[model samples]
Target chain A: MTPETARRKMTGTWSAHSPLTDVPAAVDTELAAFFRARHADYDDIDPVVADAVGALELFVTGGGKRLRPVFAWAGLRAALEGGGGSLTAPTGPGDVLRAVSSLEFIQACALIHDDIIDQSDTRRGRPTTHRRFSALHSERGWTGDPARYGESQAILVGDLSFSWADDMFADSGVDAAALTRARQPWRKMRTEVIAGQMLDIALENSGSEDPGAALKVDVYKTAAYTVERPLHLGAALGDADARTVSLLRKVGREIGVAFQLEDDHLGVFGDPAVTGKESGDDLRSGKRTWLLMCALDRADRSDPAAASRLRTGIGAVETDAEIDELRQIIVDSGAAEQNSARVRELTSDAVDTLRSCHLASPFVDELVALAEQLTERRS
Target chain B: MTPETARRKMTGTWSAHSPLTDVPAAVDTELAAFFRARHADYDDIDPVVADAVGALELFVTGGGKRLRPVFAWAGLRAALEGGGGSLTAPTGPGDVLRAVSSLEFIQACALIHDDIIDQSDTRRGRPTTHRRFSALHSERGWTGDPARYGESQAILVGDLSFSWADDMFADSGVDAAALTRARQPWRKMRTEVIAGQMLDIALENSGSEDPGAALKVDVYKTAAYTVERPLHLGAALGDADARTVSLLRKVGREIGVAFQLEDDHLGVFGDPAVTGKESGDDLRSGKRTWLLMCALDRADRSDPAAASRLRTGIGAVETDAEIDELRQIIVDSGAAEQNSARVRELTSDAVDTLRSCHLASPFVDELVALAEQLTERRS
Candidate 1:
């Protein structure tokens, strides 16, 4: 097993009852149909928008498991049953589905723009939209650089996705009150995430940024929005009260932070094949990740070599040895172990919340187990 | 006045009226304070966003008529006058003021993104965000082309503006129903414009595009969203009934078309200084405008020179003689006069709608005047 996965301290409460195995099948079916329906009107006029719609369909279908949406669904379904959502009928499955898709769309937009913003050529082992369009631009001999055109088009496509998401959610048949409830967290998740993204840009650009600041950015930017809030959003929609909702929020916040810490751990010292990404790319890109920041804070500036490597190793495409050395510094400074504890603490807290959530369904056991696996699984 | 202005037709029974001058001052006071308060949190966070906030403040301060929000406020005040709004209440002004600001924020985001996407170097004679950032990017010696980076950052900045608009709307004092009504049209406007932008790109690239097809694209893309929708949207929130709304839609569509046709005329044949643009810029850029399209449809195959000029003139920096010749070709070909009649007819249709509308307010008169000026004004 890779050392990155081995370091996790997973103590999941999920037993054998979780339905996560069924998630992928459901997500794929809905995605395909949703895409086809959204694109049906493309030919009415503006073939360029049609072209963009085509591009969106192609990109969304390319890769990545629909993990978040499924989790949201599970959380919501569990909430409904616990509250006898049958009798209340506050909202329906359609609204939940629409919300989940909106989240997925949001994820898609983020990834597309992130790819351009980061200038990565490949995503999921395939050419990114920018690269694909850049080649097309060159072949077509369009004005300016194809890469620039690609970036421009990709930016617009992401915006289209974002706007469409709002449209879809607004048009959904979910009980208005329930939809409103779900919307509260959904909106917060987006705002917090965007703010986090801005912070990320700031962290990378500023030389003064270090581990503590990076950690806070990670929580707001990645963890809370990615894992915790999706869970909290689902639970809230299912009518989880203030107390239970509060527990979920705390649980989500803790786990979300821990999850990103794990992601940070993997980024620097991971196997390319297993991770489907190059090891140390993050360090090379000079991301002000929590680990790098921590190492920077702890490093002895008296050693000019270490400081130079840490600062320059990021963003260098060819300095493999320097990247390895930086990884060593991260480990040596004990950031990895500290983050591991953070993960464990968060997982335990989440389990503690579940234990008191008044869950009657067997899915609760699965969620508990899945939460443990998220932090503990050796990938 | 040009023949176009003299021939300006009535659009609907919806007559144009001068906007109440008092509205702009009220809008300015509230918007300035609202923006300042929102950015008041910036002292503790990244100063870049704070600076962006400041730039936005300056931008809105020097904005065009706060027509969209004014309409919204007018509608809300009109709607609530006899219904729910308490004119004597202490918080009434504050509440309505915030609602107007939310509308302003949406417009602000739209304009910012529009400038970046259009890649025009100036806005109201000032250098654009993309240009300012391009200069900054070049000075910083960052990776990638400076202009491209400038565009990228500007898009993100606009996105931040847009997301902030959503949050502001959510928290606005207007009722959820008002927000809901406003939200659908807002989304539609965004979609139509983006689609229109795509159509613009497609037409630019089309080797066989006709003038009629090109004009159709221009109409759908900018005219409807920018002019007509705002007027109707404002009324929708207040006293606009179904027939009134329908009538406004027809007026907006007709006036929108005329406005775009005029813009097309200006792009190809207008004075550089008056337009704050270069002459025949569209021709040099190979833009497929209505005038060129009309010329294409009417070009005499027997006159080899006319056809040749049409081809070579595209993308050519024309000389004064060439400009005169091209202008003659457009005028002599009957394209200008024909399209001018279209503008007149659209205005007539909008004026005609006034008779059909089920509701009437001062906004109808104000909207008509703006439409007439927008469609037929020389500069």
Candidate 2:
């Protein structure tokens, strides 16, 4: 994503609501109330746990686009909306609402667990839980290995939240059949999120040390979990026929790839202030993104020594000059341009799928707009 | 615990089931088929994951007391059994059976996650998932770090199992109101188990670092999570009133302490081969169990230098003669006998709670018996 892509000042968001105006507020209210209820006496918990869980409460309720929850409601509504022949629900909204809310919890669990595994120190400008706890452990001179203990505690916190999220969604109003139907995508969401996480880790770790494994990591790690599953889940609930589901997955394929492309672009070119991330952070970490993948391919034919330099911590803070060198290598290899074209092609293909669905529903336009904007977002 | 405790095994394992001995076989058939159907494609999965998942299928189907499920079934029967000498069930046995099977899944989730958090490499002589994956990680040149990736995957796998377990029970038809009542305790069970996991971590990490925080960790971690929550969940499903729930918690208090005490004792005195653990590992690890707490208290008064020596892990994995000297110091401190006596008092008190409940159900005896056996077992 370049500054040119960020030029759309009135950039619109796509949501499942029949009219986009009402979606954000409704999602906020529903999700805020759900958090309020779960943490009604949040401070009254065991003192040791109170502070940590409170931090989580703040992280969740702080703010986001509410895209995940909106997709859930829209998906459910899309499924049952026509069954009632209006932009209203046919079934009681309790179970679906609970189910949708549970995804937010799922998101929270993932973020926490992800932070711990990544050894990331801050999230959304606050210290990560393991870092926070390890700091506390140091101050206290805790008995066992502080780092290991901190990691263990973080693991428990993540696991606890994971279980609570499921229990919350197990509402009685959702009949067995509806639940069983709904659970297929639900199953994939869990499995794929985890699979994607593995790939992300593998690509970072594997280097010229093992190039083949790193590429596979990119597919399973990012493309499938983050975008593909979320869209499929929405379609599944929207009463999609097999054709519609297939198209939706294709839509996911394009958006998911482009989403990663935009991410990689932002990693190098975007402003740290706007992204609320340090500049060159991914480069410092030596991530094997799509841009890197293409560069490696080009280097296999030419400039093998240059590719070797790109394999190690060429992006580390200590190697400041290497950042520019690394960026140039990516661009000069023609990998950057190739991936840029791929992004455009995928986004165009996704738009075609939306058109071919041929539904007269006015929401189709917004979906198409979303796919286009998604690939082009600067941050 | 000693062989004297394990030797007094209660003999009438299935005597009470003579009236309907057919029930066990029926339950076994249903459960076995469930595993076979669910895991029919086990051979097709990654050998390691296939083995991890397959282990659960085998273990669940393998004989344990099945005491938890049996209690659930009996309670459902007792609650719904015909009141006026009718032969037909007030509720179908299948309904109770399904609910009971769900409880088994919950138990499995607890055991698997516990093994990961505890870093225990084996369960009943088989390698744990982390250990298996740790070994596999060594074989594969997985990109950055395979053990970290493996642990994360194991956590996710446990999470998947836990969610699936909750789903199995979510739609179980024990009547809408009954499920509604079960919801609170069931929800609490999830929360408490997590809180307890935190407490366990805290206790293990406490050492002599933070004296003030140590005591609270002891009370909240094991006592509340392990002993208390399981009983509460069982009683809630059995339709126990608030007074009974409170009573059950008190029973948990007594039993949980004894359970931990017995655990500490086994960690010391139990044979390595029979217990499937190296004896005195706690002492070697410098774990601050109650026995160690008692020893420290004694040494502080009688011989200051001895306390320091004990804390240093002086004889931890040392020559046998050095270990004997350390063992003698612990004996001179009289920590073992004191902790054992406490276990005796608490175990007796836990049994007394059942006696006074006056429920006059066979479940009361079995539960009491289970508690006693758990606290007394040598291996």
Candidate 3:
């Protein structure tokens, strides 16, 4: 199965040939059951705890691309099918689904905490966890500052999400040895993502404008957890050889970078309705993304005045016209084109690597399809 | 050893007869090594990440009772010594130390987040994590709101602490089966502590006058993670039988409640130099502690005027004189006496349960000593 065939297959309903065809639905089902059981347990403990879990359930089950879990599933399938034999301690599909779905809770923790850090009011066109909790405090006319109340609760909610993710993985019923093996990448992913966040804060705070610094953050903050480690975790769980895991990690890193590059493009150029976020938000917030970094670098060398204007506009411009001017600078400097080209190059490299590795049929094809979808999507 | 002998031994340097004599130092050593390894790894990733880990290392290794790890260690020793013989997969002392030391990171998470929630300036007479980070931002002349920047970084630090804790536990070198058994109570403890925090926030916000509500928070927020579940985790790690675990939990719960009750007394009466907290902070902050609830209830019946004054002063009083007045009201209403009496009764009951359980001699003695220290400490 080539990329073209894989693309065509994805365009239509997934057939039996696609091993991960039911993954998204299956993950949803598992998460729903998990939350339902958690709700009952929390209620047994205290109404307040139950309410916090309810908020988390609403936020988690609300919306997500389920990309991490899908990648993990694909990694497992590739490892198992490519190995030419079942592992001594095999992971059944049910256990795989449960284990992979746990990633979403980790994602939940990331997003919940991210919103508080960014002081973001909305996520996916809905109030973020902190905002929603804040509103609840206000609506109930609770004593003390409502904002503080909201943030504190959201903090606890985020902590609970993390704890739940660990619990779910531990209870996934995978054999102890497999679970032990899986935990290696899982632990690394946890530490890297968190350290990535700290690095981001420090970078932004220091106002460092180096494109290299921005890319370094992308490697840890987005690439590792988003793609590489999830795949490594899956491969480990399947008892894949270290060589195979290493190859998958290489592919995953490339795809993860490409995926984030695409997101950077969307943050600047995509339609708000499609992206569920205002275009040029990265510029407005001065996020120092790779695209912005490239624009600044290129502008500094060739268009000094434009570079000056971009610097002045970022994190200061509020009006649409001002934002539009900054966007024009990014485009006129050829940074936008470069960003898109990099995404394509990275994605192609990732697909080529996956193909050359000779992973089992259909699993390799599915991974190629995923890489294309992630790096090529408009939103 | 009986409580009397246990108390006397605790007053002296621990002897060889004491099984858990070296627990605190052993835990400190393990944690120091863990942090050093983490620092090197974080440095390999990036300087910013390394700095963040450095801050966490300082904060975690700074100061605390190491009570949770000590209790967990005692629990393990009791189970191993009392169970007649080792299970097929016995945990070595080294593995046990590594696993138990991970609790301090969890404690770090709780304290760091608690400071953020409380908007506290200092913890243990040093600037809190958020304050420390905020000061760093200000010193660096960083962009954006310094206070928000501080909080955002602290939130990430708290998250990193939690991830580090889970990672440490996973890499604790414990037998896989033991890790699996330990995770049950570990999972419950994590959830309960976070949920307990939410409950405390909600109860405080709602101005709930019920002593039962305060007790509920104690059961989840402090008691469960701080004592009962740590003991349970140790027992599980030691592969103790179900009946022994149950008995330990029973004893733990009683001691835990007694411990919190004593903390309540100290909150209002202990010296600031000793407790490292301003006396009557619980009253000043309007924490719905059991002591406050009892005082409010007794005052409402005996002296409605005093009750009205207490309500008005709570959370509003700032001066030493004002806090002193509130303290007087509590003592006059007999709440303080009742609180002390409850602590004594609970501690006695816990010791009785421990004696009746017939656990191996010195482990039980160490536990009894620990219970007395915790419940009777000035701090």
Best by DockQ: 3
Q: Judge candidate 1 against the unseen true structure and give its global Cα lDDT, from 0 to 1.
A: 0.64
Of the two candidates 2 and 3, the one with more favorable TM-score, higher being better, is 3
| Native-to-model Cα distance after best TM-score fit, residue A248 in candidate 1, in Å | 2.0
Considering TM-score, where higher is better, how would the candidates rank from best to worst? 3, 1, 2
User: DockQ-based ranking, best first?
Assistant: 3, 2, 1
Clashing pairs in 3: none
TM-score of structure candidate 1:
0.83
**How well does each candidate reproduce the native contacts, as fnat?**
0.30, 0.51, 0.92
Return the TM-score for chain B, candidate 3. Answer: 0.92
Distance (Å) between predicted and true CA of A125, model 1? 2.7
Better model by lDDT: candidate 2 vs candidate 3 = 3
Candidate 2 residue B172 Cα shift, in angstroms, is 7.2
Fnat computed for model 2: 0.51
Error (Å) of candidate 2 at residue A370 is 3.0
Q: What is the C-alpha DockQ of each candidate? A: 0.31, 0.38, 0.79
